[model samples]
Target: MNEISSILAICGACISFYIGAGFATMQEVVQYEASYGSRFLIVILVAAAIYLYTNISFATNGNRLKLNRGGDIYGVYCGVFGEKIGKCAAMFFDYFSAFFCFMSFVVMCGGANSTLTQQWGAPFGVGAVTLTVLVVVTVVFGLQGIVNALSKIGPIIIAMILLVSVVTSVTGWGNFTGNLTKIDQGTYADVMQQVGGGNPLASGASYGGFVILWFAAFLSELGAKNKLKDVNIGMLLSAIFIFFAAGVCCVALIGHIDATAAADIPALVLAEQISPVVAVAFAIIICAGIYTSATPLLWTAVRKLADEGTVKYKAITVLAGAVGCGIACFVPYKELINVLYGLNGYLGFVLVFAMVAYDLRTKMSLKHGVENETAGIDR
Candidate 1:
C-alpha cells in the first residue's frame, strides 16, 4: 500500500471501529464518562492517554512483527509462556474476535432498530434486518471495500456528531450551567453516582481496553503494510479525532442530563429538542455510524474464517449476517450496551496486560543487550 493511502485508511478504520451507534448517540459516553459528573473530565483524559498508549504500541509492534491475523498477536506476546499455553491464548484471541464482531453487529442492528421505532414508528425487526443486509453486502466485497467505505463515511459521521453536540451544548446552556453548579457545590459524588451506574475508574479503563482491542488485530495488518511512522501518525490523528468527538458528546450529554436521563439515545434526544430537522439529520448520522462500524466488524469476523474473494467467504458472510440478525432480535438495545459491551471491556484488559508485559520485557532485553555490548567493547 502507498504510505499516504495506508495511513488514511488506517485512520478511517480506527474511527469507524471506535464510533458505533451507542458512541455516536452518546449513550456510551454518558455511561462511561459523562455520568461521572465533575470527575468525568479526569476519566476522559485518562481514557485518552490509555487509548493513545495502546494504539501506538499496537501499531509499533504490528509494524515490527508484520502479523496477518489477531491470533498472531497473542502468539507473539504469549510465547514467553509455555508453547501449549501460548497456543491456547492464540486460539482464544482469534475466536474471540469473531464473537466480538458478531455481538457488535447485533448492537448495530439493535441500535438501528431502536432509531427506526422511535423516529418512524416502524417495527424494530425491519431496522435490524435492513442493517444486517446492508452490512453483509458490504462485507462481501472484502476488506478493501469495507476500509474504503469507512474511510469515506467515518469523517462525515464524526463531523455531524460534533456539530450536533455543539448545537446542543449551546442551545442548552442552562442545563449545562445548572449541572455545573451542582458539581461546583460539591455534590459531585452524588451527581456522579446518580448519573453513571458504576465506578468511573473501572468504566474508563474498560472503555480504553475496548477501543484498543477493537482495532488491535486490524491495525496490526494495517501497520505491517505501511511505514511505522505512517502508522503512528495515522493512529495519533485518529486518537485525537476520537477524543474530540467523545469529549464533545460527553459534555453535551452531561449538560442535558435531566432531559437525557430517560432517553435511549441521549444525543438524539438533545437534537430533537433543538429542532426536527437536526433530529432527522442526526438520525441519519447515527445510522451511518452504526453502518460504518458494523460493516467492518462483520468482515473481520467472517474473514477470520474464510479467505477474501472466495465463494466460501461470501457464503459465510451471509450466514453470519443472518445469525447476527436473528440474535439481534433477542437482546434489548440497552442490555446489549450494558452487558455485552461491559463484558468486552473487561476481556479487553487481558490483551492490554499482555501487550504491556511484552513491551516491558522487550525494553529490558534491549537495555541488557546495549550494556553487554558496551562492556565487551571496553574489555
Candidate 2:
C-alpha cells in the first residue's frame, strides 16, 4: 500500500480493535469512566496516554526486533529481568494472553446476542451464530485478510459511534451540567459504583492495562509487517481518535447517567431516546464493532497455537468459535464483561511495567554503543 493508505489502514485497524463490544455498547465507558463523575476525563486521559506510548513502542520495536511471532514480545520485554525469568514470563504471558483473547471473543459474542435481542427481539442464537460465522470465516483468511476487512469496517463503525454520541450530547446539553453537579454532590452514589474501588487513578490504570494486553500481540504483528513510520503515525491517530470518541461517549453517558447506569447497553439506550430508527442503526454499529474486535482477538489467540493457513489452524479457529458461541449464549453479557475485563486489566498493568523497563534498557544500550563507537573513532 502507498503511504497514505498504509497509514489509514493501520489507524483503522488499531481503533477498530480497541473499540470492541464493551466500548461500542458503552458499558465499559459507563463503568470504568463515566462512573467516576467529573473525573471521567482524567481517567480516559490516563488511558489514552498509556495507549499512545504502548502502541508506538510495540509497533516500532516490533519492526526493529523482527521477532518470529508476536507473542515473543513478552520474552523480549521480560528478558530485561534475566534469562530464566524471561522464559517463565514469556510462557505465562503466552498462555494468559491467549486465554484472555478467547474470553474476549466470548464477550463479543455475548454482546452481539444482547444487542440483537434488545433491539430487534431476535432469537439469542441468531446473533451469536452470525457473529461466530463471520469471525471464523474472516480469521480463516489470515492476518492480511483480517487487517483489510477491519481497515474498512473500523472507520465506518467509529464514525457511527461519534455521530450517535455527539447527537445525544447536544440534545441533552441541558442535562449534562446538571448531571455532573449531581455526581459531584454525591447524589448518585448508589448509581455510580466505581471500577477501581472509588479511585479514578487505579481505574484508569486498569483500563490502560487491559488495552495493552489486547494490543500487545496484534500491534506487534502489524509492526513486524509494516514500516515503522507508518505504524507510528497510524498508532498516534488511533490514540487520538479513541480518546476523542471515548470522551464524547462519556459525556453522552454522563448526561443520561440515571438511565444509562441502569442499562446494559448505555449507548443504545441513548440512541433509543433519540428515536427507534437511530437505536436500530446504532445496534447494527455495535455488532460491527464487535466483529472487528472479535476477529483480531480470536486470530491473536489462535495464531499463538498454530501458524496461519495451516489445516491445524483452520480446525482450531472453527473449534474456538463454536466453543465461544456456546459459552456466550449462556453467560450474562454485563457480568462477563465486568469479571473478565476487571481482572485481566490489572494483569495488563504488570505487562505495562515490563514494557517500560524494556524500552529504557534498549535506549541505554544504544547510548552505550554510540559512546563506544565515539571512543574508537577518537583513538
Q: Who wins the lDDT comparison? A: 2
The TM-scores, one per candidate, come to 0.89, 0.95
lDDT (Cα, tens digit) per residue for candidate 2, span 284-321: 99999999999999999899899998999999999999
**Clashes within 3 Å, all models in order:** 0, 0
What is the Cα root-mean-square deviation between model 2 and the actual structure? 4.3
Q: Give the TM-score comparing model 1 with the true structure, all chains together.
A: 0.89
The residue pairs in collision within model 1 are: none
lDDT of 2: 0.87
Shift of residue 210 alpha carbon in model 2, Å: 0.3
lDDT of each: 0.75, 0.87
